[model samples]
Target: MRETKEINALLHLIDDPDEEVFSTVSERIVSYGKGIIPNLENLWENTPDETTQERIELLIHSLHYRDLKTNLSDWGKLENPELLQGALLIDRYQYPEVSFNGITQELERMRRNIWLELNNYLTPLEQVNIINGILYNYYKLKGTEVAYTNPDEFFLHKVIESKKGNAISTGILYAALCQLLDINVLPVNIPRQFILGYFDPNYDVLHAGGNPAHKIQFFLDPMTGQVFTHKDVETYFKRISVPPIPTYYKPLTPKRTIQLLTEELSKCFGSQPYKQAELAQLSQLLGD
Candidate 1:
């Protein structure tokens, strides 16, 4: 930002020894919004003190986080929030400067490739097979169990670039692809697992009153693109000593799915108090 006399004065006081004075100065700098970031960065470069640099870093993070919260709040209000965009917003929490266009363009390329092989005659299972083959075989995307030690796996851009993600990230990627292709795949609220369900196209319009599970043609393990049957899910419920309730089988709305992602991603920040608090706040933005 074009630094005014007041902005220059605030930048000078950022290194103040008094905690109260520094806190007040920091708040005023943040109040200027993200436009003040350039001024902070310039100060950091000329300043020799490590402590002052750290303070400037925190100021920059505060600005980015404030902006992120606003974006996520707006995203949560959408009628049918785009899954990929939601994931990208979560991604910005860690990588504020990362460009999402590359990720979008990459997804578009994959979509075009899948579209070329798709036909109107393909059955639901066949359609899923094509997606599985392209994503797993052609794209070579790998899925691992969720590991909090490796936080990067939860990020959408990192997942795309590394071709590896845990269940949540991979599931989001899968659901996003289906969205682009107009497929009826969605995430289901299976306890302790992130699974996708392939719903019958007419279920929403024709059989909306029945147990939602009855409307699902099959289930998918996002970790491997492997298919599961009703019997399989039923056996899972029995093994876990939980009843297969109607809600468990219902497709999750995009908002809920993104909120789930945010909640899961928050687990990776347990060691960083500021990050954990920030993620908790982000998740609250999507709260019911």
Candidate 2:
């Protein structure tokens, strides 16, 4: 009650004629962070002044954006930030009101379904096949073939809800499920494509191998869960007239992977005039 009273008092000063006084009041109100959002919102509802209402709206947006930056930084600091959680954090930037628990429940349900269809006796290839069947065949999650203008295709929750995504979003889902099931699949940063490579369980990713490509059992296209061999990757490089780099064959850390998702999302906003602010925020987040 006391906090509400204090917040309301500061909010009343939001429309002060003096720029200095209003700035001081605004800074104090924003310092209270997201906890003050409801109070600001309530003040906006009861207040008749258009200027004060706009100030309140700005304060609310500022708080939400601050919270978003904090959450993303925290995710980066986590020892093992899982793919699903990282992607959801990115999703929250665009959907601050989205329910984290609801997203978790939906993903958990899918993970459980994929889990039930496998066992210790299954070979690596067999495991991949089972997950592929469940994800593409049964669930019908298809890729957006040419979603150059579709930014929503990069959000994992949107992908889950729509059953459609581009390479990175779908790859994150596929890799997350594989990790949960103790499968050794990890995302590899293939140029112009996001893909996964099934690693040998005993292969030391952190240490030396004659070639990093040797660490991969095979590659899978996230769009369709289609498996491919090293020879296929080589063929792709030849087709593109680009030389294959060994680093491209290695797995990306969870942070790097999320960065890729954010980068791709920002590019999609190029043609969206109204989304310029969002693109700028994403670019800043990517820089951090």
Q: What TM-score, over all chains together, does every model reach? A: 0.97, 0.85
Residue pairs clashing in model 1 are none
What is candidate 1's lDDT per residue for 174-265, written digit by digit as tens?
A: 99999899998889988989999998877662247878988899999998999999999999999999999998888887778888887888
Candidate 2, residue 49: lDDT: 92
Report the C-alpha lDDT of model 2 over 1-288, residue by residue, as the tens digit.
Answer: 246677768877888989899889988987987888888787889989998888788777777878987888777878677777888888876777888788778878888998999999998999999999999998999976636677789888898999999888899989988888778899986777788999898865557566678889899999998999999999999999888888788788887888777767777777655355654565465443
Residue 67 lDDT in model 2?
Answer: 90
lDDT of 2 at 112: 90
Output the number of the lDDT-best candidate: 1
